[model samples]
Target: MGVQTNPCLVVLAAYSLILIQANITPVLAHVINQTESPATAAPQAPPPVAPVAPVRSAMQPLQATDLLTADKPCSHGLERQMPYFGMGAPGPSGSAGIPGLPGAGGAQGARGERGDRGEPGLSGFPGSKGDKGDIGAVGPQGLVGLEGLNGTKGVKGEPGRDYTPPSMSAFHVGQSSNLQVTSGSQIISFNAQYINIGDDMSQHTGVFTCRIPGLYYFTYTFRAYSHGSYGLNIDLLVNNVVKSQIYMTAMSKHLMQTQSTIVTLRVGDDVWLKANANTYINGDDEMNVFSGYLINAI
Candidate 1:
């Protein structure tokens, strides 16, 4: 009675409210369980995200038109070209290299031409003479060579002077003095002379002296007149020595004898006649003569 509602309408309204409560209650219960038991909940997959691009400066992009066109101002468009790098100057000369090993010897060269001849040298001095050698043995005689022509005759020589022979002579006696008959020897004195050349005869000594040495000839003649029986002997003496003798025996008559001889006389020699003792001589000038002469000079 309060308004006395229709019954059907009221049932319908309650039913509709019940349906809304059923759906709202499940949703609320699910949220409550997730909050209470997170470990037990299934993980959810995240959504897909886009890739990030590289960071870029705030510059404009380059283009072929900006590079080709020189007059255009492209300050932030073209990238600044890097500066070209050139090779540097050659480095300082390296240090001197080490000395290398010696090379092989070279081949022999060709021979040179011959030189000109030299001048002649001066002569040497002569050497001294050597000593004489010893005499060698005598060799056999060699054959004689042919004779040469004869020479002309020479002039004649002068004639030599002639030589004269020594001359001496004694001839006759001038005086008679010896007239005795004695027993001993005595000299007969022919007291005179005729030719006594060279004055070699002496009248006083009754001797003939030789002036020159020579060969001489002597002659003596004696005449003895004796009264009684007596022997008369005469000797020719040379230098007081008897060289020759003459002997005669007279009974009464006068006896005459002549004797001649040759004798070699030296200088200063003497010749004289001596009578024997016991003989008498009549000293007569004509009979008793003693003479001598040089035949040749010695």
Candidate 2:
């Protein structure tokens, strides 16, 4: 049996062994479909993956869904994570941030309960009663009403100089005994009371110039007859100026008088005579100077 093999070379050796088993059956099924499957053990092909930058654990807190989880890393990725979408509904609530500094003074708030009486103001109409005061003056005629006494025997009046006759009257008008004054100037001298004109009108020196102009109560009598004499720049001239000046006294023949000034005269007021005749001394006497009024303050 071993001597026959040439039936066309045994069909070309079984068609070249079926064309090399059909090219080794697709190279053994492409090595069994690139072969790692003995219960799935050959997929170790994931080593070229280098985009992993999300390992933040400095004591961990990175969970915004683990920042786009892919084991957290598309190079810090939750799809490049920054999409919180939460600001749209809160736009109307942002106007209250300026009140933080007044918090330290808040412990005194418990005293408020007394306010319920405010509704009664409309009834005013009655005020008019005041007028009754004047009825008082009928009393003067009762000393038992009468006069009965006549037992006569008296007449001894005349004792030289106990003088007191001046309800008011005086005058002086230059027959010059001294008159020359000028310093805050004022000069008015008069002396007169002549109903009987006797002692040369009793010590003569009277000039009566202003006849009638209403108010005229005045008096200025001055005399400093020696020792550094000074008194009488007599100022009480109503319309010719200088209304008040008559003060003199380092006196000698001393006759300083002034205090009855109530003037209002106006009609060429020429109250004359002012003497500072350097302290006049020819028998010291700025001779009885006078001016008067007060027949009732004028």
TM-score of each model, paired residue for residue: 0.44, 0.17
- Give the residue spans of candidate 2 off by over 4 A: 1-212, 223-225, 228-273, 276-298
Top-scoring candidate (lDDT): 1
Number of clashes found in candidate 1: 6
In candidate 2, how many Å is residue 90 off?
Answer: 99
The alpha-carbon lDDT assigned to residue 13 of candidate 1 equals: 65
* TM-score for candidate 2: 0.17
Locate the minimum summed-lDDT window of 10 residues in model 2: 194-203
Candidate 1 segments whose C-alpha is farther than 4 A from its true place: 1-175
Best by TM-score: 1
Error of 2 at 160 (Å): 54
Q: Write down the RMSD of candidate 1 (Cα, Å).
A: 41.2
lDDT of 2 by residue, 23-57 (tens): 46655654665465756666443333333344354
lDDT of 1 at 26: 62
Residue 270 deviation, candidate 1, in Å?
Answer: 1.2
